[model samples]
Target chain A: MAGKAVPNATRRSERSHRAILDAALELVAEVGYPKLTIEAIAARAGVGKQTIYRWWPSKAAVLLDAFVALGERAAQEAEGPGSEAPYAFPDTGDLEADLKFVLRATVDELLSPTYDLPYRALAAEGIVNPEIAAEFVSRVMEPSVQLYVERLRAAQQAGQVAADLDPRVAVELVTGPVTARWLLRTLPLTHAYADAVVEMALRGLSPR
Target chain B: MAGKAVPNATRRSERSHRAILDAALELVAEVGYPKLTIEAIAARAGVGKQTIYRWWPSKAAVLLDAFVALGERAAQEAEGPGSEAPYAFPDTGDLEADLKFVLRATVDELLSPTYDLPYRALAAEGIVNPEIAAEFVSRVMEPSVQLYVERLRAAQQAGQVAADLDPRVAVELVTGPVTARWLLRTLPLTHAYADAVVEMALRGLSPR
Candidate 1:
């Protein structure tokens, strides 16, 4: 579906797309994923249902796009201008600091009331819906996970990370704990928690 | 609420409680959480709804107990017989090997279709419902998370883990990754993945 409607997507179409995404997120936060409907999203966006359907096949698809856009925007805003890549991990020759930065940002986002409700709505849907879960893994989650994998590979090449470790699996070692803490939620999420995760991940759990 | 129930739990009451829990699990799996009802549970268990309410305050309470019982049984079976505790981590003075064993079993449980469906149902409920989420963390999740904390502290005293590390947060260093890998299903959950998490967590990601 890439570039299938590029000619159709004039500047006005981009405005409408953002409006629909915003509307979808608003409605999901208000009523949750189970009750969110295409009609409501279109009405709230001041667009017709046909317009929403023309761009995305389902509400879940629209939400997938909405969250991806939201995450990227958050990442870009956090990184500031003149950065090489928005979501890519920084390589100042310090893997621990870089990981903590990204994870702390994640903690902030997860703790934000605005992001929390809608994301949880989508996550609830994803838990039951296989199609949405697959789309999330491939389109949203995997790409983000891959960024860390890329950064870890860079660390390996720089001789900071162990050469024998698989970067993909190693990425999970950090991401897993952070996401688990967020998802399960027995304690308040903080930069301190993120720092600990980074330290334990970098300097082994055994005595340094 | 704990030992007090033993005096009231005649063989008949014990049988009734089991039936209700079973009915709740079956109904949740069959129709999902939103549709599950005490009336339905009562009908399925061949008991009156009053009988259920007499023991548990709500459907959520019944489900929490149901899941707890299920988890304990699984842990007991996995640990073999004569273990000091059902869900407690084994300390053969080898933190890495012991962690891998528990994590591998977790991988097996997460991958099981029976456990997967009901858990997803309850977890989906927990995600949106604040009260249920709190109950889940305090009751279901924390008990198990504490076990890891205990094991980690044991390692710390033995010099197998860092002296300065917080066992509570350190436990997430491993649990976080395993749950994330399970919750976000881009990769297959397996013993190999569990082993990778264990190794990275204990040995650190750096060249050392």
Candidate 2:
């Protein structure tokens, strides 16, 4: 078996990687994170348990990869026609419109069934498991959030946002309600709600 | 067994109830929600599994009750002197001060070791379990959120907030960052953070 496994077996290894990730995501969506196991994922993926062990440290690692893949795909789909891949928020010099546009896309993603189940399971798991949660945050949540931070910083430079505003907290003001509503199920996560959040956050809650 | 179970049964039942809750909380904190079981709780509480079964439908129910009890105790301790049982947001006719006060208290609760462990466990459980999440929202999260809604409504009526603003979404502007900060561990949830959130939400994120 050791002799049969070559150092340059790139195609076979890539096939196994895809299979493992797909199996991990399906199992997590079906049985949830707690019941998901390496044995089960390997069996479902038609790979040996050793094959999975060779690449990933734990089930959380597999799930994290699956989630990142899903997010990347979603971002690509949300990008505009003839746009470059891995799209950034458009700097139209109109902060409100740009934010509203991005938030509307976010609302759609949050509401999508494909993204919702696995992501929710991962997020729930993260809440209790600090190690896994840290991975999820650093690998998945923080990178995307930094996009908003970058956008806000640009806006600040342009005098659209308050110059002294903390871009991190400012990004949260825009993103937080969308997350809170989806996570808590407090209200319908509609485009209207997203628009309202952008409006309120950008315009302030107090009367003008 | 039934006939002999009457003497001090009421007192015994109350004691067992408290014991069961404590045991459930401890087990969840130690081992997490999926590994937590009725038998373990019963054994830890010095009661029969049947006793737990007779009272609650599932481990989620036991944890939920335990969380409610914990929150109630925390509220009692946090309430001010001459306060009417700290259930609602205290409307002292100063929106900013009232909001800052409540959010600072929330920051303390989120930071405190006593509340963090079991609450995080239950919140983790609630995220994936829709039924439990609904119960949590309707019973705990919403009622607390509604206090903000009520306060915002009063602010709207007082012309402090825009008449067109939805108090529901308005409340999220105030509450969402605190929750985001706590859940994401993105920043230190200090009184200063709470104060900044209050200022940002009240004044809006727009440039003056």
The candidate scoring highest on lDDT is 2
Clashes of 1: 4
Model 2 lDDT per residue over A116-202, tens place: 877887777777677877888887778778888888988888888998888888888888888877876767889999899999998
Docking quality level of the chain pair in candidate 1 = medium
Kindly list the per-residue Cα lDDT of model 1 for residues A124-190, writing each as its tens digit.
Answer: 6677777888887887777778789888988889999999998888888787877766666657788
- Model 1, position B143: C-alpha lDDT score: 76
C-alpha lDDT of residue B167 in model 1: 85
lDDT of 1 at B203: 90
True contacts reproduced, candidate 1: 0.84
Measured by TM-score, how close is model 1 to the native structure? 0.84
What tens digits encode model 1's per-residue C-alpha lDDT throughout B65-178?
Answer: 888777777767978766655476778988889999999988887778668866776676777776777888887778778889888988998988989988887788887887
* Superposition error at A52 for model 1 (Å): 4.8
Q: Candidate 2: where are CA atoms >4 Å away?
A: A1-8, A73-85, B1-7, B76-88
